[model samples]
Target: MERDKLVYKLKEFQALEAYQVDLFQSQIKSLEDPHIKHAFERFTVREQEHEVFIKDQLYSFNGGTGIVGPAFKFAGMVTGKALDLLSLKDRLKLGIAVEQKAVQMYHEFIEMTRHDPQLKELNKYLSYFMIDEELHQFWFKEHLARIENIEAQPH
Candidate 1:
């Protein structure tokens, strides 16, 4: 793809991701557990920071006025509300899946963009997010396993 087209695509992606920022904050409200609430709070902050960085990257194009991204069909905030209703086991399962999805998205971006010299810096930025997502997934999964083990007990 041409440089302009690639840049445009990235801008759109950034915008879509930016739209998801509020969902993270909403999630923190849904979590009752102090540790989980705190974790989501951190995720919320990072997401907001990520939005700013993406906006800055798009600043030169369209005067930083265009967050023209593809539409996200599902209501993510509604998902957070639903998560609040689920049991801890269910929430952990879904949270881990969410992190895994983020990791997958970064890998896909890296795979598609790494070959382009222009995208090298974006790939580097995405790699950092991927690592964080992986770590979050690990943290959640470990807790989930402990919960499962306790439930599996003969008590």
Candidate 2:
């Protein structure tokens, strides 16, 4: 991939990571369960790390960390606020859906980097990010199952 195109893609991913960090941070404030809140806090930290990594990559390519688009920023905030009103199970379901999409996006990016020798390091980092997303999706799925199981049990 051309350097300019790669940088553009990196900027997009960086914006996404930033959005995830903000979304998770907002959700953490709304969560009442200590365990779930702690999990979201950890996720927010990891997402921040991912954002920094992408920003570093952008810097290396001379692509300054550009501001996220106002529209995208607004959408993330709205989604996060809407999610805050959902029940725990509904929130977990949405989390699973979002993580699944993120995992797929990372997978596509990893594939794109595969054919370019210069992008190997970026590919490795993306793989790590994908695994983190998968872990998050797994946590959401497990928590949802537990909630469903308890609801199904005889009173």
Candidate 3:
């Protein structure tokens, strides 16, 4: 791809990530468990920070002005509220699936953008994000296991 095209694609990707961060933040409010709510809040903040860094990279590459981070974050808050109705087990299962998708998407983004100098730093960031998503999957699995154990015991 031409450098200009690549830059545009990177900016688009950043905007998409911002949207996702917002979605996750919105989901946080629906969580009944304090621990889960806290975790989601922190995770949302981290994602927002990641979006900002990506926006900065895009700007540095070509003086691009993307969507505001807060706007995307508010969308996330709405999503969280909508998802709040799910049970804990159901929510964790959903979260695990979401993280898996994120990991795959990040990998694909890295592969697709490997040739762009404007995207090199973003690639590294995605690599770290892949690790974080994997960790989230693991945590969700652990929570699932604990829930299973609790359900197994006789009253």
Top lDDT prediction, candidate number: 2
Total residue pair clashes for candidate 3: 6
Listed in order, each prediction's TM-score against the native is 0.77, 0.88, 0.74
* Cα lDDT of model 3 by residue, 1-155, tens digit: 46565566556557656765776677776667798788878777877777787677768766665433332122222243556676788777877776676677677877877886766777788788778778877888898889999999998
lDDT of 1: 0.68
Residue 88 in model 1: shift from native, Å?
1.9
In model 2, the number of clashes is: 0
Model 1 TM-score, 2 decimals: 0.77
Error of 1 at 68 (Å): 5.7
Residue 134, candidate 1: C-alpha displacement in angstroms: 1.1
| Backbone clashes in model 2, listed as residue pairs | none
Each prediction's number of clashing residue pairs: 0, 0, 6
Q: Which is the better candidate, 2 or 3, if ranked by TM-score?
A: 2
Over 76-146, each residue of candidate 2 has an lDDT whose tens digit, in order, gives 33365687688888888877877787788789889888888888898999999999999999999999999
- Single out the weakest 10-residue window by summed lDDT for candidate 1: 71-80
